[model samples]
Target: MNTIEIKKISKVFGSKTALNNINMSIKQGELFGLIGADGAGKSTLFDILVTLSAATSGSASVHGFDVEKDAKNIRRIVGYMPGRFSLYQDLTVYENLNFFASIFGGTIEDNYHLIKDIYEHIAPFKERPAGKLSGGMKQKLALCCALVHQPKVLFLDEPTTGVDPVSRKEFWGMLKRLQEKGITILVSTPYMDEAVLCERIALIQEGEIMAIDTPVAIIKSFTHPLYSVKSKKLYQLLKDLRNFKETYSCYAFGQTVHLALKNQDTTAIIIQDYLHGLGHENIEIKSIDAGIEDCFMELMKKTAE
Candidate 1:
């Protein structure tokens, strides 16, 4: 079953759109990801789905319940963990968990089976006030509280942002565990690497959806061929490559500039002799396997045009 369905959803805050003409469907038990940098409208879309705000147009449903007409029913079956930690700062870990449980008309003991797996890791810190806990610790507590009600649809908006690298890995491991329990998860993150962890992802930019597919499929769809170009004079090389007639697109990606070729005729032999003539020797330019980020940037450029 489709746990979440959105059709042509658009949200405008007066003159600007926070979410524009978005459409996506997430099936039950699927780990769906909404990936983009901040201000990409991920949070706005999440807020609308969770009933924290209303869409200016279009429609959405969660677990077959319409977000507009049956929002109350949807709330009962959806768990939301916003981008920021929303737990009471003064509340101890245990108290915060218990408080959420009460709000759902249940007790920690009643939901122990649902959260014990994750909660146990922080059980020793149960008495620590949430405000005093480290960022990673706070993440775990927020997740535990969100799961206290055992909702079927889970929403996480950049849950790993601002956390340590080790903690980020551990948190994803926890998410995998939750997936085993058969909950449909919708997580949003700007981290391109994390796109591989989801069953499918929708890349967004400027409040618009760019591409939606499995990470592998998205990476595979990158056409026109790509090459990593680098040299001692990186800055000059970047400028020259952009002006190269054969270069379709060029952007600095880490240690190299990713080049999208304008045509297949521009061979490495041609590029090499051209750069060599420009006083740039020992240049590194070779075909490189494209990744999710590469595909996303390319798609964003296409969308803008």
Candidate 2:
């Protein structure tokens, strides 16, 4: 069964469209992701789905409950952790947990089993003010609070945005554990690497969904022959590659710039020779596998055209 359904949903604020006729159906127990950078309407879409804000047009439902008329029922069945830390900063860790639990008429003990693994890490600092905890600890506490009610659907909006890498990894681990226990998660993240952790992801750009599929499938759909190219003059190499007549796409990828030739007609050595001719020394160009970011870039280019 699909846990959430959205149809031609759009949200406009005064002069700008935050969401543009978005459509998606998320399956039960699925770890689905809305992958995009900030201002891509991820938060707006989440607000609409969680019934915190109404859509300007079209419809959305969570667990068969309409986001408009049946909002109260939707709220009861969904656990939402917004991108920001909205918990009371002045309250102690334990107080925040207790407060959220009490709001849903649940005691921490009532849902202790659901969040035991996460809560235990923060329990040692239960007496500390929430504001005093590190980024990772704050994340764990927020998650524990969100799960205390044991909601069937979990909505996390960029949960790991500013957290440390280690905490981000550990948080994904916790998500996997939650999925194992049958909770449907709809998470959004600006991190391309994080998108691969989801069972399926929808790549959103400028309030529109560029593509929706499993991570592997999306990467496999990349049709261009891609190459990782590097040179001593990294910045100049990027400009030169963009100006290359045969260059289809060229973008920096960490230490190397990914180059997609207009045609597979030129070999890596030929491209390297070409760069060498242009005064670029110590140049390296090699074929490489495409990842989620590559696919997203391709999709965005396609959509822009």
Candidate 3:
């Protein structure tokens, strides 16, 4: 069963359109991700679905209840965690968790199993104020509160941003555990590396979804053979490559410039000569697989045209 549905949902703030003709359905027990950069309207969509804001037009529903007509029932069955920490900083960890649980007319012991995995990790910090805990501990506490009432649908906006690498990994691992519990999760993150963790992902840019599919399928759909070029003078190489007449598009990815060409006939030797002609030394170009971020950049180029 689909736990969340967005149909032609459009939201505009003053003169700027935040979301336009966005449509998606999230299945029960599925981990769906909204992938986008900043200002891509991820948070705006979250607010609409969570009933914090109303869409200018169109509609959305959670667990088959209309967001506009049955907001009270919808909110009861949904748990929302905003991108920023919204917990009371002065409250101790246990206090914050229990307080949220009580707000939903439930006790911690009533839904302990639902949050046991995440709560156990922070139980030792139960006495510490939320502001004093580590980033990961704070994250667990936020999740525990969100799940305290055992909502059928969960909406998380950038839940792992600003955390350390290990903590980010742990956060995603926790999400995987949540998915197994029959809860539908709609999460948005600016981190491309996390896209692969979702069952399906929607790549959004400027309020438009450019692509929607599994991570492997999206990466595989990337056409045009790509080449990664590296050199000691990385910046110079990037500048010279974009100047090449045959270069279709080129963007810096890590230490290399991922380049797509207009003519597949251009040999590596010709590319070498052109770089040498431009006085670039130690240039290296090799055919390699495209990553999720690479595919995202390519899709953005397609959308621009």
Candidate 4:
């Protein structure tokens, strides 16, 4: 069953359009991701779905409850962790968790099973003020509070953004465990690497969904003959490659420039020779598989055209 459904949703603020005719459906027990850069209307769409804000047009529902008319019911079944750290800074970790559970008319003991795995990490710091904890600790506390009510659906807006690498890995592990317990998760992130972790992802740009598919399917859909090229002068190489007649798209990927060829028959040696002729020393080029970020870039380029 689709735990969440959106139909032609749009949100406008004065002259600017935050969301444009967006439509998406998330299945129960699915770990879905909304992947996009900041200000791509991710937060706006989340706000509308969580009933914190209304869409300018169209409609949305959560667990069969209309966001507008059944907000109270929807709120009861869904847990929302906004992009920002919203727990009371002055409150102790234990206090914040207690408060959220009480607001839902439940106590820590009543739903301890639901949050035990996460709560144990912060249990040692239960008496510490929320603001005094590390970034990762704060995140765990917020997550425990969100789960304390035994919510069926979870909405995490960039939940891993400011945390350390170790914490981020640990957090995703926690999410996997939650999914095992049958909690539907809809997470948004600008990190392309994290997109692959989701069962399915919707790539959104400028308030519009560019593509929605499993990570592997999206990568397989990339039809371009892509090659990664590296040279002594990286910046100049990018500029020269962009101006190359055979280059379909050229963008920097870490230390190498990922160049999509206009022709499938183009060889890596051909690219290396071209760069070498342009006075580029130590030129290296090799064919590479397209990743989620590559697919996203291609989708964005096509959308612009």
Candidate 5:
């Protein structure tokens, strides 16, 4: 069943449109991702679905309960962990978890099994004030508190935004475990790599979903040939490639520039030779597989067109 549904949903803040006719559905036990950069309206959509805010128009529901009409009931079954750290900083780790549990009529012991794996990582610092904890540790504690009540649906907005790579990987592992327990998760992240980890992702930009599909399917839809070109003069190469008539698009990707050619007639060797003529040494250009980020960039380009 669709655990969450949105149709023609739009949110406006006076002159700005936060969400424009957004539509998507998430199935039960699905780890769905809302991929977008900051100010892309991911947080706004989360607020509406969790009953924290009202939409300007259209409709949304969680578990078949209307977000506007049955907001109170929806709140009871959903756990929201906002992008910003909202836990009580002055309180100890143990106190914060217990406090949230009390609100849901649950004790730490009652839901220990649900969050034990995550809580154990933070238990060593249980007596530490939340404000004193490291970014990773605080993230663990916040997640534990969110799961304390065993809510059926969990909303995590950029949960790993400031977290370290190791902690981010560990957190995704914890999420996989939760999905195994049948908890529906709607997570938002700006990291394109993280979007690939979700079963399905909805790429949003400026409050609009550009594409919705599995990461693999999205990548497969990329029809253009992509190449990774690098040389000693990287910046100059980037500028030169952008001005090249045959270059469809050129953007930096790590140490190299990902260039999409306008047509297949010009080969990589031709581009490399052209750069070589421009006094660029150690030039390297070759076709590379497209990833989720590549697909996102392609979609964004199309949207701009």
Candidate 6:
């Protein structure tokens, strides 16, 4: 069963269009991701789905409850962790968890089984003020509070942002455990690497969904021949490659530049010769598989055209 449904949802604030005709359906127990950079309308869509804000047009529902008409019921079944840290800064970790549980007329003990795995990490620092904890600890506390009511669906807006690498990995591990327990998770992140962790992902750009599919499927859709090129002079290599007549797209990727060609027959030697003629030494070019970022870039470029 689909736990959440959004149809032609659009949100406009004066001249700014925060969301543009968005449509999505998330299945029960599925781990879904909304991948986009900041200001890409991720948070706006989340607010609408969580009933914290209304769409200017179209409609959305959570677990068959209309967002506008059945907000109370939706709120009871959905757990939301906004992009920002929203727990009371002055409250102790234990107190915050207790308070959130009580808001639903329940105590932490009543739903402790739902969040036991996550709560164990913060249990050692239960008396510490929320604001005094580390970034990762704060995140865990917020998640425990969200789950304390035994919510069936979870909405996490950039939950891993600003956290350490170890913490991020541990958090994703926690999410995997939650999914195993049958919680439908819809998480948004600006990090492309994290997109692959989701079972399925929707790539959002400028308030519009560019693509929705499994990470591998999306990568498979990128049919262009791609090459990774590196030279002694990295910056100049990027600029020259972008200016090449046969170059379809050229962008810096870490230590190398990813080059897509207008003609699939273009050879590495041809590219290397071109760079060598321009005084680029130690040129290395090789065919490479397209990743999620590559697919996203191609989609954005196509959308622009």
Model 1 RMSD to the real structure? 1.5
How far is 35's C-alpha from truth in model 4 (Å)?
Answer: 0.5
Quote the lDDT for 119 in model 1: 90
Model 5's lDDT to the true fold? 0.93
Clashing pairs in 4: none
User: Which pairs of residues clash in candidate 3, taking residues 3 or more apart in a chain or in different chains?
Assistant: none
Q: Is candidate 1 or candidate 6 better by TM-score?
A: 6
Model 6 lDDT per residue over 184-268, tens place: 9999999899999999999999999999999999999997899999999899999999888889999999999999999888899
Q: Can you give the TM-score per candidate against the true fold?
A: 0.95, 0.97, 0.95, 0.97, 0.98, 0.98
Clash statistics: count for each candidate = 0, 0, 0, 0, 0, 0
Give per-residue CA lDDT, model 2, range 211-289, as digits (tens).
9999999999998889999999899999999988888899999879999877878788788877988999888888999
Residues 41-118 of candidate 4 have per-residue lDDT tens digits of: 999999999999999999999999999999999999999999999999999998999899999999999989878999
- lDDT (0 to 1) per candidate: 0.90, 0.93, 0.91, 0.93, 0.93, 0.94
Candidate 1 structure lDDT = 0.90
What is the TM-score (0 to 1) of candidate 3?
0.95
How many pairs of residues in model 5 come into backbone collision?
0
lDDT of 4 at 230: 92
Residue 150 accuracy (lDDT) in model 4: 94
lDDT of 5 by residue, 214-286 (tens): 9889898987889999999889999999988899898999899999988889898889778888899998878
The TM-score between candidate 5 and the true structure equals 0.98
Q: Which ranges in model 4 have alpha carbons more than 4 Å from their true place? A: none
